[model samples]
Target: MNMKEANKKAVEIILKGQPTLVGIGKALDVIPGMKEDIFLHAGPPITWERMSGPLKGAIIGGLIYEGKATNQAEAEKIAESNGIKFAPCHHHDTVGPMAGVVTPSMPVFIMENKTFGNKSYCTLNEGLGKVLRYGAFSDEVIDRLKWMEKTLAPVLKEGLKIYGGEMNIKNLIAQALLMGDEGHNRNKGGTSLFIREIAPSLIRSSFDRESVAKVIEFIHSNDHFFLNLTMPAAKCIIQAAEGIKGCSILTTMARNGTDFGIRVSSMPDKWFVGKAQDVDGLYFPGYSLKDANPDIGDSVITETAGFGGFAMAAAPAIVQFVGGTPKDAIRMTLEMYEICEGENDTFKIPALNFKGSPTGIDLAKIIETGILPSINTGIAHKDPGIGQVGAGLVKPPRNCFEEAFEEFVNSMEKELSNE
Candidate 1:
C-alpha cells in the first residue's frame, strides 16, 4: 500500500483497539518471555554499566524482591557482574513507568486488545514516593512490592475473575477525559472509575473483608494507581498499528534514564535514539532542578496513543502538577495535533468541544513542523534510592525525531528503487 493508505489503516487499527484489564498474574506467568533471571525495564534497552542511577536502584530493589540479592550491595555486585539479564518492557509487549523494572516474582496486570487480539503487560503501581519505579531500593520499597505481590495482585485477580467481564479500558479512558484526566501524570478520574468497576467483585470475593478494605483503600489513596494500567493499555492500543507497510506514524516513545527512543510503524524493530532530556517544572520543597534526573519512563506510551500530553486540554487541572497555565495545556494539545496522523474518536476532550485527542503521531509531521511530543512526568531524583522529587513537562531530544525522519526518507527511497 502507499504510505497514505498504510497510515490510514494504521490509524484505524489503533483507534479501533479495545484494551481491557483482563486480570492480574505473576510476571513470570503473565509476561511473555519473562524469566527468573531477566530484568525488564521501562525504556529502550541498555546495559548495567550504561544504566542511570534510578534504573540501577530499581534493579537492586527488584533483585531483593526476587530474592536474587539480600541487600543493596549484593544487588549492585550481581548487576555489575552480569549475573542477571536486562531488557526493555516494550520488547516483551509490556510497558512500565519511571524506572520500570520488573522482576520474576512481581505481579503484573494483563491487558488485552480485544479488537486486535493482542496482549500487553505492566506491573501494578506502587503509589508515588520512594517507589521502585522511581529507583528507590530501600527496605520500604521492597516491603511495599512484597505486599503488592502477596495481597494486591491476588485481590485484583480474583476480583476480575468474579467480575468475569472485560473491563472496557477504552470507554474508561473516554469517560476519564471527560472527567479531567489525561490518562498519565494525572489519573485520578481513571483510578476512581477503575475502583467503581471492580469494587463490587472485590467485595464479593472470598478474601477477608480487611484485605478487601485495604486493597480498596490503597487504590483510593493513590491517584496514580491507574498509571500502570494505562501504560499497557496504551501499548495494546498502539501495537495494533505495528508493521503496516509505509506507515509513518510512531508506535513507541520511551526512555531509559540514559536515552530517549521512538519506534515507527514502518520500522517497528528499530529504535531511533537521542540523549534523554531534563524536565522543567515545580519541585518538592528542598528539591531543586539540580536534583532531577533526565526524563524516564514507558508512560510516554500514553502520548504515543494520543492522550497523555496530546490531550492535555482535557485535563487543565494537570497544570497543578506539571507547571503550566490552563492556556498552556490547551496550546500543547493544539500543537500536538499538527504532528499527529489523526484524532482519537473514543478518547475525546471536553474542552475542545468534545473533539478527539490528537492520535497516531506522524514522524513526518514532527520533523516538518519542528515539534516534539510533550510529556508530563514525575521527576526521579538524580541519585539512586532518592525516589521522586517533582513533576514536570519534558520533550524528547529533537535528534530522535530527526533520525526517524531520515528513516522515513530512506524507506521511501528503497520502495521507489524496488518499483
Candidate 2:
C-alpha cells in the first residue's frame, strides 16, 4: 500500500477501540499481582543491581505484601536467588508505571475499547511520594497499599458498577484538555472530571457511610488517582490500534527495567529502542539528581499517545514538576501538534483559545521536525535496590525513530518488488 494508505489504515486502527472502565472489582484497584501472589515488573528483565531506588522498594514491598519475605533484606535474597521470576508486565499485555509489578489478588482497573473489543489493565495509583508506582515500598507505602486494596478498591468498585457501560474516555479527555490536564504528568483536571462522572455511580454503590467518606477523601486528596484510570483508558485505546500492516502508529512505550523501547502498529511485536534518559525535575526532600535513575515504566505511552508533557500548556501547573516556564508548556504542546496527525475536536485546550488538542504522532511529521517526542518521567537511582528519587522531562532518542523509519522504508520497497 502507499504511504497515504498506510497512514489511513493506522488511523483507522487507532480510532477503532478507545477504552473505558465499566465495572466494579476489576484489577485496576489493586497493585500488580497483589491477589496472585506473583509480582511482575516493567519492561524486560534485568539483574538486581540494575534496579532503581523506588523499583527496589516496590519489589521489597511486593515481597512483604505477598508474604514472600519478612523484611527488605530477606526480599533481596529471594529476588536474587530466582525464587521470583523477573518478567515484564508488557509481556503480559499490561504496563506498569515505575518498577511496576502486580501480584495477583490486587484489584486492577480493567479497561475495554468497545470499538475493537480489546482490553488492557493496570493497578491503582499508590498516592505518590515514596509509593510503589514511583518505586517506593516503605512501611507507610505498604500500609497505604493495604488500605487501598481492602477499603478503597472495594468501595470504588461498587461505585463504578453503577455506570454499567464504559467510561467515554475520548469525551473525558476532550473535556480535560480544556480544563488544563495533558492527561499524563498533569492530570489534576482529568482526575476531577473522572471523579465527577463516576461520582453518581459511586454514590449509588453499596459503600458504607464511612467508606463513602474515605473514598471521597481519597479522591479529593490525590490528584494522580485519576492517572491510574487514564493510563488504562489510553492503553485500551492504543492497544486496539495495534497490528495494522503498514500502519506506522506507535502501540507501546516501555522500559525493561533497563532500556526504553517502543513498538509500532505494523511492527506489532518488534521494538525500536533508545537508552532511557535520566529524569530532570523537582524531587522530594532528601532526594536529588544524585539519586535519580534512567526513565522507566509503561506510562510514557500516555505522552506518546498525547497528553503527558506534550500537552503541558493545558496544564501550566506542570511547570513545577519539570521546571519550565508557562510559555514552555505552550510551546511543548504546540510542537507536538506539528508531529501529530490531527487535532482531537473533543479534547480542547482553553490555553490555546479552545484549539483542539493534538492527537496521533505522525511518523512523517516527526521525521520532518527532527524533534524527538518529549516525556515527563520519574527518576530512579542508578543503583539497584534504591527506588525512585526524583522526576523530570526527557526526550526519546531520535536514532530510534530514524532506524525504525529506514526499516519501514525498506520493508515497503520489498512489498513493491513483490508486487
Q: lDDT: which candidate is best? A: 1
**Candidate 1 on 173-194: residue-level lDDT in tens?**
8899999999998899999999
In angstroms, how far off is 135's CA in candidate 1?
0.7
Q: Point out the worst 10-residue segment of candidate 2 by lDDT.
A: 28-37
Model 1 scores what on Cα lDDT?
0.91
The top-ranked prediction according to TM-score is: 1
* Candidate 2 similarity to native, TM-score: 0.90
* Clash totals in order: 0, 32
- Listed in order, each prediction's TM-score against the native is 0.99, 0.90
> Where does model 1 exceed 4 Å of error?
none
